[model samples]
Target: MNTSSKQDERIARMTFASVYPHYLAKIEKKGRTEAELHQVIEWLTGFDAPKLQQLIEDKVTFESFFREAIINKNVHLITGVICGYRVEEITNPLTQQVRYLDKLVDELAKGKKMEKILRSSL
Candidate 1:
């Protein structure tokens, strides 16, 4: 595989539990609450608080985390740049999904209104 695919594979194998702290810290540092982060996550992944906690405790990899997720139907509305990639233009499904989450978190950190960040109208 090429280097990009190799990097994607490594990201897929990474544990959600390991990444959760960084996500949490990112928003928290921006004065966003944990609950807001959870709301955004739930909107994207359809995982509730209890289930999220359970998944974290289980140390599920990103692949497993998404494999088991009931991804939001409106996920297509999640568009924009994240990690230097335009999320809407990403061809890899898993990478797009990961970037969608990243975009939401980034929006929240940037002080976007929750309604807009969640794409509530769309």
Candidate 2:
């Protein structure tokens, strides 16, 4: 692969790795149920982490893996990054609440609204 492609891949992997734990901590601090948090952890550290790592190792562009994650119901992985949510809660709380991509999209569409909801709850 070209240099830029390799760099994008590395960035993608590093981004996920760097941000995932932060997401988890937020979820825990938010008082998400233990069962919910566990689910998020399973998805983030299990399938999501390994898949992202492999995509980087295979020299896939960040955009490619990002798109695939959405197509495959792994959009939470990306959403957590953008919304500053706990990665661990992505799969647990939000994952369960979101039953479809459209639903996730809608919630994300109301980004500021969601932020308000989260903030008010706190």
Candidate 3:
């Protein structure tokens, strides 16, 4: 397999619980709160606080995490480069969803307004 597929394989096996703390720290360091992070995540994946906590506690891998997700209808609006690849341009659906979350967190850390980040107006 090519490098991109290999990378996707790694990401698919990675656990959401392992990454959650890092995301929280990245945002909190930028003066954002856990609630804001959750809002962003919820907007993308439709996981509420309790369900998200359950997933983390259960140590679900990214593959399982996304498999169970209720993805937002406006996910098409989440366009941008994250981790060097354009999320919209990613051919792999799973990888695109992962990047969508990354872009949302990055936007939150960059202090984007919640309404815009959530694409509420669009």
Candidate 4:
């Protein structure tokens, strides 16, 4: 398989829930709370805590998870490099949405204030 196909495969197969724990661990180690992590995710994806858990329980893949999301209106403000790629510059729609969450989580872990992470009036 080629590199592009491999990237697509990984994104298509990876579950948001599968990645959730790692995100939690990274933030908690930095003294950040899980609630805060969830908050940023909710801010970006418009999923409440319960709905977020449902997605995890159902093991939704990243592509499906994002496809079904009611992305926040302020999402356009979440721009930056995540995992070495610019979220805004990502050509693929699904990839960009995934990176938006990743970037938000990265910002939360890095101690960016919630107001900035949320990018609106809480």
Q: Which of 2 and 3 is the better model by lDDT?
A: 3
Cα lDDT tens digits for candidate 3, 1-122: 12288899999999999999999999999999999999999989999999999999999999999999999999999998888888888988888888899999999999999999999977
Q: Model 4, 1-122: lDDT tens per residue?
A: 12266686688789988999999999999899999998888877888899999999999999889888899887778787887787777777777788888898888889988888888654
* lDDT, model 1: 0.89
> Which candidate, 1 or 3, would have the higher TM-score against the true structure?
3
Per-residue alpha-carbon lDDT of model 1 for 17-57, expressed as tens digits?
Answer: 99999999999999999899999999999999999999999
- RMSD of each candidate? 2.1, 11.9, 1.8, 2.8
Better of 2 and 3 by TM-score: 3
Which residue segments of model 4 deviate by more than 4 Å?
1-3
Q: Candidate 2 lDDT, tens digit per residue, 10-55?
A: 4444433444344446555655443443334333333355565565
Provide the global lDDT of candidate 4 against the true structure: 0.85
Off by over 4 Å in 3: 1-3
Comparison by TM-score, 3 against 4, better one: 3
lDDT of 4 at 41: 85
lDDT of 3 at 43: 86
Best model per TM-score: 3
Q: Lowest-lDDT window of 10 residues in candidate 4?
A: 1-10
Please list the C-alpha lDDT of all candidates, in the order they appear. Answer: 0.89, 0.39, 0.93, 0.85
